[model samples]
Target: MCHIMHIFLNIKFFTLVDFCNAISYEHVKLLSILKLHNVKFFQFFTRFYQYHQGGGFVCVTTARVCSLLQYLFIVLFSTFLVECVDYPVLFNNKNTTADGIPITGKRHIQLMTLIFVLGIDDDNLGNLTWCEVLALLCQKLPDLHVIITKDKLNELDICQRILRFKNYFVALVNKDMLPPVVNIPFLGPQPYLSSGLKLNLDFLFFWGSFSPWEGPYTLKDEYKDPQNIGKLSNSFVCINTQCHKFFIYTINSCIPSVIHFFLLCGAYKKRSNTKLRHFNELDHQLQIRLSRSYDFATRYMNLFTSPLIEIIAKSLKFVTGSIFAVLFALAAWDEDVLTVNLEHALTLMTATFLIVIVCSSMITSDDCVYMPERLMRSIIACIHYAPISWEGKAHTRAVRKEFDSLYPLTFRYILEELFSPLITPFILFFWVRPRMQKFVEFFIRFTVSIEGLGDVCSFAQMDIAKHGDEKCIFILAIDGVAFDKDEDYIANDGKTEISLLNFAAMNPLWEPPPLAAEFINDLKTHVSCLSVFLILFEHILKNVW
Candidate 1:
């Protein structure tokens, strides 16, 4: 390096002399002066070039070389140290920026892009959950630019967090291999492909066909080594465009340690199949450590396993405590869900006999009550075990269900369940087969109403059924068809009417009277038992309402 500097310095000296036409002896004297005082050599050379302008061939040859040296220095320094080019703004995420382009399709580039997180079903995840990592990522990155975020990171908070980004992109992987496989049966070709990521970025880096369910982020398996099975790309974070050099990495091959730090903490998903579950339960100790840094892959393999150890411990406690609680409670609890010790065995026997006598007398006393003995048995059993009941510690099944309820219910899971069959059976069936919901809803309401009476939905259904297979009375167009018109029939018994405009097709959007035929047949077949439902319902409503 010093020699290179010297050559350039000498070139400067000769160029001044020759450009000014200095003498050869003058050049020799200047060279000597440069040798004596290296500190002032440049100044001396300049002054000598100005004062002695008759060096002939000596000054001219050296002057040209000096000029060449100056250009060479400019080129080398710019390539190595300074910005090779300037780009004031970053543009690549298409959703946020018009300049955004699909980048992950480029294999070499994808390999060069670091895998921030690999959401496998359940292998290396040590102690933490991907959900918590996602929360942290949002807290840190705060932008919709990455795939796993809740909203666009461009919001003020996210904008501030984004300033911390040393890179242009962050990939968030959603591990679909988690437990409790809940696949929608109806969505055949068009499953509700979960969009794994949500982001607001100028450029998006994606590799696979990226189903709407897959990501705002990219994936690892989506871009394998082509020849190998699970080979990964270690040289990620280098696939940046030349323009990103100005804004992201100050040098090639320099991925900010922040990404790997996140990878270490975020890789602990319970299972990759966590389609709609929140997985953020890290152990107390590791969580404290993780909160300290956003870039921590420097710790090596320990980084991957530290959380795993804690998870194993917590999980052991979870499983054993849960299993034990269920077994103990079930063994201890009696039919009334009352705890019973050996001393209370006689008391339990007496209570059972008295209850049986009372129930038997009630059953035999009334013909209506006796008629629905099986249903009465069901009601009695329900009294023995209830959904919301928590009074007794002896109900093992209840204890088992509440095992993990010690933690606050995850809002994400709640939301997912809301869209599922947890509450509205009709909602689930509606997506695949609407006809099924009509009958199912009618059955529930019918069984529940008992007295052959029900609220609006049930009444609406009964009215529709009574008008069996009838065309909608509301379709009163000029081309309207009247009810009971055999000319425009829809259902099996041929009682319902169809519209003239519709020709022969029935209006599927609006069901034929609620539960047109199947519901009627099922209800009639079970009416002897169903009448008891009415009696029970009337019994309850009369006393309660």
Candidate 2:
């Protein structure tokens, strides 16, 4: 019996030592993790105390507390770094100015011209004659004046003159006298073609004016009058000329104004996708750390049997203690009274049973009433990326569905139950109000940019296309019929076929509906205006009544 008792004592002592060692190790591990993440011990302690006061640590073991602290330290540290750091903006090196402004296609052309002119060698300039110099200057500048007091131009060295010109150019740029950068309109062929082909095609379209339909044609006797032919040809030419002029005017006058309006409205706010992505990534990391902490805390606490059993044991003790106190009171009362009423005794017992059951139900166990960590995480994520209007409610639902689909049905149900109460109020306060303000701001800007030219040009283009196609077909038919020599005029038939094909290729400008490029540009402007206006109108109505 003594030998058995000594062995039992040794085992108990060893078990106690192991438990103490484990607690010490966990404390050290937690401190190390906090330090690794650059979290100060003082801040950690402050937060831990606050968390404890918040009832987060109620009924939780010391090891669980350590795990919770470590998780919080990582999340808080990451959030601090993200909020404090101002990461440098990165710009593409290619086609970008020294100050990191992107050089648009139009600005690029002007820069290239300036470079080419300045790159001329001194020897090459010296060999060029006066006429060549004047021609080169004409190409460089639209307005040129050469005032010379000297009788002979031979006194001026072309190289020195060019160098002087370059110095003047530098001085102007230094003084900020240069024109503001502009994106040149892509007025040539569509960009689908290869660069070399596009360049050649653009050159031909720019310099060549030979129309396939403007070839030699013998009119019928009734239509043979030279004056009548001249009048007929002049009308067609006038119509085409007017159409080209209108197109040019719209692009040159209207597009720039619209662009300027949008700019002024601050519609072109510079937002970095990379920064948003970084924020999202930080949020994800925080979520993972929280999950890990919960797992660690739960595992450590569960090392001792089930928490539910412990809760039940605690509840039974409370009920038994209450019963004993009641019995003692009743015995004392019975000593004071001759006898207790049977009905009163029965009522007292029944009331005590009901009270015990209710109190036990209210005594939530640590396992049963844990923090809604997953639900909290989902809410935080939604708050971060939620759309700011009822217009985007469908989108929010779609996003929720996608995310929810990743989880099992049991988890999904819990998340939905928690999320439902928060969704409406959170979206209204956090998302909608600020977005409405932005909508009003951008709406004013869009209205200013359009300057009442909204869709007028688009409508005109459509009308032109509708009428132009009919006119083209009529003109082609007249040419084919007038030039027909006989029923067997195979040669004339071939020419007419070729002409029709060529016309078809060139007729894209006057095709129904508009070019895809023009349509997209117009659509963007229309949608911007319409969306902003509708949102503002909705906001006003909502506030008024």
Candidate 3:
């Protein structure tokens, strides 16, 4: 029936003809991609569901489970193959590198650059205004400054506002030959100058507005949530050394964001949209930088973070070589290798299954993020890409309903499987540990230290970041230093003279986990109960059943 349904859908799709009956080619492509991914997901989840449903005991013939798993790998590999074929078009090789344009120095980077907008239709508020952004940069960049490098600059209020800054310098670029994009082929965009900030900048940041291009739309910024990754590229930055780091990671994360942005924005005519243009670009750029810190958030910080980390960590197990090994070893013959592997299977399976669970949690997001890159990559393949969004409203509704329908059964099944191993630990940790800790302050206090400190720092940073320093300090005054450290802690050495770290550590906010020695009493009770139940069940199933 499932096979027949699949065939029927395929036939109907190809047969459709007429205006209303027709779907957008993009939408059609999305369905095709979704269909493939959905199949992979279904096969994986079905086996996973069944594995946990039957009391979490595999007890199935090893050969049978092994076969399903092999088939599962093939389906998943096909998805990867589809992606490998599709990701190149939307993104070019290498991330944006801070390469040569001859404006870098060691302690001082003196750049005289222009943000030439390629074009903006006169009707749109955001078509090409750099007023708020220029004002904000001139104000915030400490000792650094910018000058009006072009005569055209004097013509706009945004540029005039910038000229008023304490350290502003001015120059006028020739309007006729303005480089519209940040990077041009023959001669790069106007170079920027950062005297003392060259060494410390996350990356010497700047952009070229699409003022001159007169192309399709305004090009504001081409990045989102970019991160400084690996080694610095060419970032030498001595007056003559002239090093510049390309920041590949940042550029990669931005591609999808930029493409999506262009798609949403590109479709509109300049005259149709009128919106206030304010201090948006700079704030957005800073936000992107901050989110890169998500790479460091611990599991305790966010439950979701652990799952993503686990997915990235386990990517090796699903490698082509690994898949080949499984295929190569499939004879199931009675050789020393088979026996040895079988003996080790239990341990490996436990680890593999746990990893798989973590990866599965990110499947939805992973699917969303890569779908466009994949589809865009396959531009010539004619395979339509899925809508690249975390929230596809219509799709979300369907997923929610589907998830809800499966939730009760899945949750119950998972709970049953999970409860077996966890029940003893839960009782020990929650019930037993508390009783022992009731008498021991030192042990109890030590167990949750990071969380305590994390709560303080995270909450404080979040507040300070949202409101200004004054607002943060004002709010801080009321929270009142609970401990002496609060008074002395330094937030960041680079940001300000004030220290928040002293306050961070001295607060005695976080406590470390307890050693097992302390929890033995509670553990004994749970372990005993669990052991007895297992033994009894074992005999009942083995002998009675």
Candidate 4:
């Protein structure tokens, strides 16, 4: 018995020593890993601060290179950033002129023109000859002009006075045709595609609508003849001198003002897709689908799995804790129950902070409550896992950074929600209200009144006849009637057509209209051809390799 006990004791001692060594090594390894991460975190933030402050060049360049990626970051990061810093402080940190006028799109375009079009260096942007100014106007200016008869000399005088300030006038006219140059990428020291760009500008000047603003902003009065209020523009030139007043300039420039107002009212749709149930409020087919989706999600889908629900649950807990804390404070302070004292007040304040901020933070941090165990292995994975592609090193890092920024996984999200009520009103009043006119114009111009459907978004109707691309080779003649391919109907980017096809495929029982059937066939043919071309190209490249 003594011999067996001695052997067991020796084995236990060795095992304990080994365990201690393993623990020590793991502890050191963990500290080193954490230290590395801390350094990387500090460097990342320092670089981000420097990058954002380096003028508008970075933002503009990023937007041009990958607009979708830029938008994703803006949506994901801007919200979190908004909580920490004011929007003006975040976006307007760039260097500005001594006059404090932030760089506008108009100014950017002129700068680009000076560099790319005129081949003028940055230092010599202001230096211009009378001939050079005229040349710029003749080449880049929009075709729009105001005709004044001899009797309307006052108008001519006004025009002359406007032209006196040639620099500003040039900027204004350039705005009419070309989009802001900030949208265009920088093309180094040498002017790239200067000839083609100049030719395109010249074409726009001669053929495009000559208006101060685009089609969406055109007024109803602009379309009507000054002499005869009812007479609008029509096809073909008027031979009669009297009919000259009704010359058609551009259809877009002649849209009624009321349409613009309507567009503004309906521009911002709520995030919820299935909120509208009535057919009148939505499309007939859309209404049915929305109803079915809502019903199915409610019945079969786990509501707790929704991120929105998780947020709401956290908010409710915070609210409840806050209410209880307040109630407890009121009850304890009541003269009848206990005498109010400084010590008691201080204790109450501390308890309130603990209940509201600290406890709420703890509750919010527990993100696993809503996420399914099957979907994610643990809370660590749920928090750190970012679905990002590894194509470009820089791009991948940016997307990962943005994804991390989106889910701070702290009390910040809850705090943001708490403060949103105070901030949202100011945003609506100052930002959205000021631009109400533009929004209204967009809605009115894009919407059309159908016979049975009443008023619907023109884009949603999928009317190839009205909005179909003329250059789309897939469009074929059905029966005796030929579909006109001359009109530019590139609205919705074929999303509506794709959605229709998807719906048809999902619901095999559903029958499409004759026109829609024809459109689907053409689209399918186009897609098949594209697929074949891609496959063949891939095969050829593989064989070559």
Q: Which of 2 and 3 is the better model by lDDT?
A: 2
Q: What are the lDDT figures for the candidates, one per model? A: 0.28, 0.31, 0.27, 0.33
Those runs of model 1 whose alpha carbons end farther than 4 Å from true positions after fitting are 1-208, 212-394, 397-509, 512-545
In terms of lDDT, model 1 sits at 0.28
TM-score of 1: 0.15
Minimal lDDT window, size 10, model 1: 164-173
Q: Each candidate's TM vs. the true structure?
A: 0.15, 0.13, 0.16, 0.27
lDDT of 3 at 419: 29
Best by TM-score: 4
Clashes of each: 56, 0, 59, 11
Arranged by TM-score with the best first, the candidates are 4, 3, 1, 2
Off by over 4 Å in 4: 1-395, 400-416, 465-494, 513-515, 525-545
Candidate 2 segments whose C-alpha is farther than 4 A from its true place? 1-43, 46-382, 387-400, 405-408, 411-545
Error of 1 at 46 (Å): 76
Q: Tens digits of per-residue lDDT for model 3 on 85-133?
A: 4445435554443333554546542422211122112233234233332
What lDDT tens digits, residue by residue, belong to model 1 across residues 1-545?
12111111211333332222222334434544444232232233233322133232344445666766765665566574456322333332333323435536432311111112222112233343433333443343322122221333212122112111111111011211111123446722212211111111122122223211122221233232243322212211222222332232222112212222223223332212211111121123223323332121111111122345445545554554454455446556654333433445445445544544433322212222212223322322211111233323322434323322221123333333233323222222233122322222222222212111111111112233233343333321112223444421122221122111111111112223233333333333444454678799999999998
Per-residue alpha-carbon lDDT of candidate 2 for residues 1-545, written as tens digits (9 for 90 to 100):
12211111221111222222123334434433444121121123223223222333232344455666765665566685687444442323344223335546532211111112223332354465434443453343211112122222221122112222222222222222221122326623211111122222222212123211111111123222334444443442344233442343333334333333333323212211111111112222223423433333333222233457657756775876587467657757784322343435544556666666655544544554433333323332322222223122322444333333222233233333333233322322333233333322221221111111110111111121221232223322322222222322121112222222222222323222223234323334544675699799999999999
- TM-score result, candidate 2: 0.13
